[model samples]
Target chain A: MTEQRTRRIDVPVLARVEGEGALEVTIRDGRIAHLALRIFEPPRLFERFLVGHHYSELPDLVARICGICPVAYQMSALDAIERLFAPDRQSPPARWVQRMRRLFYCGEWMQSHALHIHLLAAPDFLGFDSAPAMAARYGAELRRGLALQALGNRIISLFGARSVHPVGARAGGFRRAPSLQQAGALAAQAEQAVPAAEDLVRWTAALPLPAHPQQFNCVSLRHPAEYPMIGERIVAESGLDISVDDFEDHITEFQVPHSTALHALLEGKPYLVGPLARLNLNLDRLHPGVKALLAELDIEFPSHDMYHSIVARAVEILQALLEAREILADYAPQEPAHIDLQPRAGIARGASEAPRGLLWHRYDLDSAGIIAHARIVPPTSQNQPRIEADLADALVGVGLDEDEATLRHAGEMVIRNYDPCISCATHFLRLTLDR
Target chain B: MTMPPKPPAIGARRPRLAVHKFSSCDGCQLSLLNAGESLLALAERVDIVHFAEAGIVDEHAEADIALVEGSISTPEEQTRIQAVRSRSRWILSIGACATAGGPQALRNLGDSADWIASVYRRPDWISALPASSAIGAHVPVELELPGCPVSTEQVLAALTSLLAGAAPLTEQDKVCLECKRRGQVCVLVTKGEPCLGPVTVTGCGALCPGLGRDCYGCYGPAENPEVATLAERFGDLGLDAHAVARRFMYQQSGAQPFHRAARDWRQRARPAAPPAPGAESGAAPGPQPDGSTDSHD
Candidate 1:
């Protein structure tokens, strides 16, 4: 074998991403030898911190975990605490309130998905280094995505009172439900967002996609009724069905050296979790339009080529917006914002579809409504191993020198495929392959 | 037009900006990207020498503006933070983790080694430091922007001010001030809820109180927080001392002053005194007479 030249494409700064991380690739004999997505964010130990705190304060406390998807955290925490109050029974929250909360979570997905698709993922599809550059060519598309994201924020602000880490989410339910007019206004905003979302789905579908199918264990919440949101059972790509309580049994967390976040293995195997997982497991649960759109895009599971994450996110954005409009159209003002909760003094587990993927929460509350112990598994941590695996697989057969721009671009594509939240890793990007 | 006055220089590197990480959720650094329109403008002014989350390629030794997020946990991070401090001219710590060890600091109260053993199947593979501490504990932090995921606007304001050679403005007052200003009803007094607003810092702007809930204290403690007095006040809100103390130990457990005061109060409030000596002598050292003992005395 002939010796090959290698160059280093070190990302001192990562952009359009939520957290901090670096991507390193190595080349030997003109073939990709190694790739490591190093996420060095300090671990805040949120699970450790939740110990000794009151159950009432957990939603707000953990809400600080992600700036983009605070509602997801808030909703999952509420679900867990609510389980303590009514473990075997359904919640007493008014139907309208439940409807509104689901809509609120949809708003989060719309904004987060649009931002990821347009500002972060779009650059890779277009031949640009960043969204700012992409904007020069597709200003209308960028603006439309911004509008869609802004509409999602508007809905969140309606019931949540603020877009990021809203004050409304609590152990019981929202502190205050939006007035009919406020809900109506939000619904109106989302109504306008549907077309833009549809446009995004179509645009993303038109992009060049690499066809490679990697066996993946897609994990998500399974709901028999409407698409799973705040309520459902956890399921995986491999026909493993289990309640959220069995999550610890199925997926075990282990601390790895390259990343600060503890990665989880499903039955000692690396698996995939995120939008793709959700769409694949809940294909029957989506809004008809979204389901049709998914079929149109031909995005069935076990497919390799992580770039499809962008397309999946875009489709979800459309579904979220469509769901938001429906919930808002039937807005009812007098619904109880919360159901009275009495902590059951037992371990309660809850997992919700966060914009990124399944956000899992386990709370061990005491008799007096105080939290005895807590375990939180953010989507990013669940996806860590899959990210490393994909990077390794993508690196194969590529003959670019490690320092070569092509190798670096391929490395980023692998990362962007999972839309890996390295900030969630250190704790969690947009892409450009610089030639 | 004087070329926008060429950003205020710190050193030969045109203030090469380097973003560093520790034990954290990377939320605070993401605040930089969340800056949106303002970020593009800010990027033009600063060299943005190194930001891994946003993907810039610059040597760590060359950064001038070092934005450190998260807390120090691993031994490697201890050394890495020092290296970061040496490289950057202005080290601005962002978020609660950087300023006061963040939520992860809860490990400082317990044995982190035990935590690793409990969480991981093979603890030997896990290499971590004994405790998690704020970035300022090791290096001189020129400024601090404290929050769970430092506020985006605050990040922009701090960077803009620093670039203009001005001191960053901060609300050192308590969250109570923002709540009162907003005319939100006191959740603790009226609703009989436990609140940290009286003593906790005010970055979240009394958001929880405005929603009829108590403050979770994501912003950490206020300047010169009278935590003991606040703990006493919690008694008035129908909470026991233990319940009151639990608030400070929640999200901002790393805040040394607040966490220590709370723990001390907890240790002082035991109703059960130690058991008699011979009554449980060979029985695993029963409680001592005073209730203060080395493993039940």
Candidate 2:
């Protein structure tokens, strides 16, 4: 008679992700039976709390959703509310306003991506307990990464006054505009850091990554001429294109038993978003210099491998640095930094690519511009389902007989690849096994 | 330019520093990582034992100083905080969420269960406390740093002070004091803007007022805030009673002074219709009971 045994791998607390979570995998008779990326973080209930706030307060209020990507939240809220104020979209915002918004977004991408690549994700690749431990060996590399991040923060401060939860962005535009001198300083810093960003691309590309290529349905915003950052039409690799207003038709969120965060699925299946998706969908839209650098480095494009996100993020840092310099060079102090507008009763939706992935917001406003109904879908929440699907696939190859530490490390690596901001998800796994 | 002095070594064993999170945006903790070059320097001086965002998890490790972010909003978190307090030598509550329950504490105003049911389809699966509370409510805090997201320089200063065996320097003065020092014109007096600088705390370098806008009070309340006076002044600037109350209650809603000021304005905004004449005069509606001092006897 053969005996059947059940083995369980439980991670009580997942480290390195933005917020609190756990992973529980149950192996029954040498096969993966159950897997859950449980997010037990206490729900902050941001959507409910936003119900009674005035439209003018949305920018500052939504920015508190996630610290690492406050700019993303503020920008998305502004985009949504502005649409309600100007439904025609015939009179676009001023050229200066558009340029400044991109500049602010560039700062966020640089700071957020640099933090992920250096401090959060690098430890996994280097076999260190943490970034501080990795710093002892890779001090110079870490220094360059941090310096680039500081430059990003400096640009944010130029417009927003402070990096974290900046108050510069409002409904119509920024509260104030940066002078030519401030722009000049940012330009000089960006120009100096361009080489470092380029180095980061090459450095991350050279990291030892496990090649586990699989087809993924990539989704991101697509602009006609520019690399999509602000607001644009949503595009998917599987021939799905829709306006921002039509996002609810294509993507649906549902509650799961184990997690507080609602899992987002595209057409009833897991889909990928963020840097990897952005690059795969908009590689041609990248700057000429960025394209040339990619070619020179001999890295293949349209990669299905999830680990390539690190390299994609590095490429984005380089692109952001170059773009920031160009914008700063062309910047001039424009009069009336913001245009005043009165809010009317209407419903609108706005979506933007956050440092992590697509962040979408919808608002139904009353006649007095008070929020009637509000819905926010952060990138992390959308990515949670895809992360779980990827984990299930990755763990199948690992032998059931492997030690617990090795199994847990493999699981953590898989989760960190998405740079899951469980904090943004606001959203656990406890393991129970039956033998 | 002179370089800042290196952080002095405390003893033969490096002092362990652990950072814990409860319910926050993770911005305050990120500020520590965003210190860039100085972060590496600080790393050399102290042993960072537990910082989950940085991929270091040692929750049970004893530490010399523990910097905690966010607020407690769950039963599990409530128990976890007590455990954190037991293991740490000194606990520094960082950010507005840790010091004053943050913006999410607005849920304390109404029923949290109703809020949860409105958002979630299956509210039974969700487990949360009725109110989001600051760390001080759960455990004794050695220090409190207040901000929507704490300033990185302030974080470094606090860490440096602890290493040097000195108290962290903080200004108990209002943001108005910093605005004066920076030689900035008062937005409230000159522009008629409803700035909270008069009652808000310093440490943000009077950022909003410097940027040609009204101060939104991201750094919570200052010592001895004349909140009623400021609320009345905001009303004078064309903000209605409700708007004035919101201004005080927005970011640091859980703080005692801000909470009281907001409540008072709410009462003043719509007085309760004089309580229907003699309803509050202790008059019996249907039948009067016989008034007797020794009825039982």
Winning candidate number (DockQ)? 2
What is the per-residue lDDT of model 2 for residues A90-176, given as tens digits with 9 covering 90 to 100? 444455677788999999999999999998898888889788889889999989999998888888888889999997887777888
TM-score of chain B of each: 0.83, 0.87
* Ten contiguous residues minimizing lDDT sum, candidate 2 chain B: B288-297
Residue pairs clashing, model 2: A38-A428, A39-A428, A40-A428, A41-A427
lDDT of 1 by residue, B35-117 (tens): 55556666666667666555454545567578888778777788888888878777778888788777666656555555555
How does each model score on TM-score?
Answer: 0.85, 0.93
Off by over 4 Å in 2: A1-3, A87-93, A427-435, B1-11, B270-297
Query: Each candidate's lDDT (Cα)?
Result: 0.70, 0.82
Indicate which candidate wins on TM-score.
Answer: 2
Give residue A335's error in model 1 in angstroms: 6.3
Worst ten in a row by lDDT for model 1 chain A: A426-435
- In terms of lDDT, the best-performing candidate is 2
Measured over all alpha carbons after superposition, the RMSD of each candidate to the real structure, in angstroms, is 7.2, 7.3
* Candidate 1's TM-score: 0.85
